[model samples]
Target chain A: MKVIKTVNIFLAIAILILSVNLMKPLSITGSSVADLSDAECYFVNSGVSNDIPIDGCCYEVQKQLECKKTSKDYRCYTSESSERYYVVNANALNYCKVGGYDVKII
Target chain B: MSKLSEDMSKDVKLMIVLVVVVIILIFFNFDSYGVSGEAANTDNIQYEESTNTLYLDSLTLKQKIAQMVITYHKETNKERLQDLFIGGIHMGAKTSKEEFMNSIDNFQDGSIIPMFISVDLEGCANPFENFQEFPALNEINTKEEAFKVGYDEGKLLKEMGFSINFAPVVDLDDKIWKCRSFEGSPEEISEKAKYYIDGLQENGIVATSKHYPGKTLMLWDPHKYVVHAPISRNDLMPFEKSIEGEVSAIMVSHIIADGYANSENKPSVVSEKLIGELRNKFTGLIITDEIRMLGLSDYYSDVDQMYIDLFKAENDVILNFDINLDNLEHMISVVEKAVIEGEIKEERIDDSVERILNAKGVNVIR
Candidate 1:
């Protein structure tokens, strides 16, 4: 009876360890958002400032980011940047995360 | 059961537990592990969805970044060279035919793309290497001498496996570049550079016209801090001429051409619109001068982000980002993470690589 009880306890302990191991994630820190689907159009800032850069948009939907941070998910901007947006990746989006902006990858 | 048999069963149970524990450890924390050189770390990062086969798709993200940096070597590190997969390397001044040939051979041999083995043989007396001398550039009074200067320099560089020379400082300021420049008006510099540029390319070498838009005209040295030149597009005509002359690449200076597209007074290295304007005008690769220059140091307060911003600024090759491989790896890692995080597109990398490969005379895979 005691030996059977011991086996059950050991098995229970093993199972418990396995569950915890499975629960321990490698890292759950940053954004887990999938990149924007192919062919999605987005705005790219000609000027950069304190902005997070993003990528992966449908090509057809892409447009110019009229101003610097004024654009969605945009960060860096120059004072001269007016309300005019250039298509994303048109000049290799000059995104700056220096301001600790959580770059939203569109 | 015998005592030995009982002991064996116990050992088997312990072994099973150990195996289970090891397997669990490996499975839960395997994200850090990589199969190749510093690339697997980007497993979680986002990448450009370029479907075209440009020979770049086959490379790991690390190699893609490597393609964008150009470093120099007092002597080459072959394994680290291949490991980093750097695009090009320049040697200081002159090297003997033997040292140059050996390192260049190994570098090209180990590279998947043809390396842009380069040197800066700008003038007659090579101040950096002291290998040989051509007549001083400014002293060359006639057109034939300019070509002769280029041809002689090209012959020596070609024999030594040097494919690129940062020469013909097209900047019109004679005082800043001193003897290194053609020391004349923008028109004169352009006229001289045509023969010089042609002489090098025809001799099977590529020539790079540097200090874009005339930093030489600025009183302050960009090697120190931002020189607010505030020069207009007209001032940069010599660089345009060199570009039109079919020089393979134009090395952009750190000086701010505030008058031209640069409203924020930012160095051209950090300004997209400034570099973009240059890109619009010039069809070939747009290379940055060097990242280690103090002008950059004073330009950005955050060192780490400065490295990231260099790429964001859209320079084809980040010349002298860092020399040490480990330090270079850290720099590369920051870029790798940016790339994976979708701050930049993979096609952005592909574009630079294609330009670099084409400039190096490597047939683009299309």
Candidate 2:
């Protein structure tokens, strides 16, 4: 009789725990940024036009910093010293200015 | 005799325990079934025509314009606040959740009259940290998870004092990265959007489906410039499907579809051929996209002129987000001028105001 009473108490406690678990609040987190691949170099160079080869040197900077090259007359760099010359037009330069890109005139 | 009584007592005790367990199981099962049955009944109520009404009231041109335009967050001023009392303010994308709730609370204080507060909460999280407290301005995501999310948000928004939610963006994008198509595909969008709309509207927050005739091809943001959508009748199928749903409001987009059948180069907002003719097919309220978008302001070159043209086209509501309350006030005056000129009749203004007031469920007149 003692053993039966003990088992019943254990079963009741287990059922109460399961019910509480079912009532637990649900939380959902957004997974928006998980798919994006990290870029190697992040730079903001002015005078880099939209005509620049996006897959070459420009792709790394664009994907990393969300920057678009708006000019044909421009230069970009991994560091300040190793600057690569990229051509962009005047209209593209204006586009860069409007987009708040930092242009260094070398 | 004592042994016989002991056996009988054991049997009685066993019977009582079995009865109690059965009662507990039945109670739990019935409670679950009852909750779901109530939800199904509410869904049925949405389709009933008993809720539809045609409110006919005499309203001035100013009241009509007030009913149409919603101002952005930053454009609230004393004159602007006064204008909202006289007219309504268009809640803009730039407006934070906190600012909107505070404005609504202040408006409730009788300093400014209650105008319709419309928000684009499609892709945004609740901008207010304490949004739960207001209950009226809670944000909801359009996901499969939306059933639970919307219920919680809608319940909270009702508590906070919000009456309208410009939400459940039914615009389906074939392209994956349209920057704002967070909901689903065309069929999926319809299903999820219906669920989300029903959830919010059931809780009393009016759900508005936006970017009408769909926004799948909007390459450029209309806030900056006129966007042209290059799609055929196939793309428009989703919007047509969406209209068939229990949507309370439909917001027209500023996109121009040159390729659309007979709608060459004309933005949907000014296209009487589209918004007036096509949308008339659906018996629902029609609202224009933001007046300040490039398609409206830059393309037309005159906001007042554009409003007149749009009104002539039978566009019901003018949506503007940029906080230029001064411009909204001028727009109201323009509509008033049109009314006096006999271009737009007082009855038309009354009809529009009635729809606006009914949509907001509040009276403008104190």
Estimate every model's Cα lDDT from 0 to 1: 0.59, 0.49
Of candidate 2 chain B, the 10-residue stretch with the lowest lDDT total is B39-48
Local accuracy of candidate 2 as per-residue lDDT tens digits, B8-125: 6675576557556655755654442222232211112111135443223333345455556555443336444543444344332212456556766665554223555555444322
Residue B349 in candidate 1, Cα distance off native in Å: 1.2
**TM values, all candidates:** 0.65, 0.57
Docking class of 2: incorrect
Quote the lDDT for B209 in model 1.
Answer: 82
- The candidate 1 chain A region of ten consecutive residues with least summed lDDT is A56-65
Chain A TM-score for each candidate, in the given order?
0.27, 0.26
For TM-score, the strongest prediction is 1
Q: Could you give the fnat of all candidates in order?
A: 0.01, 0.00
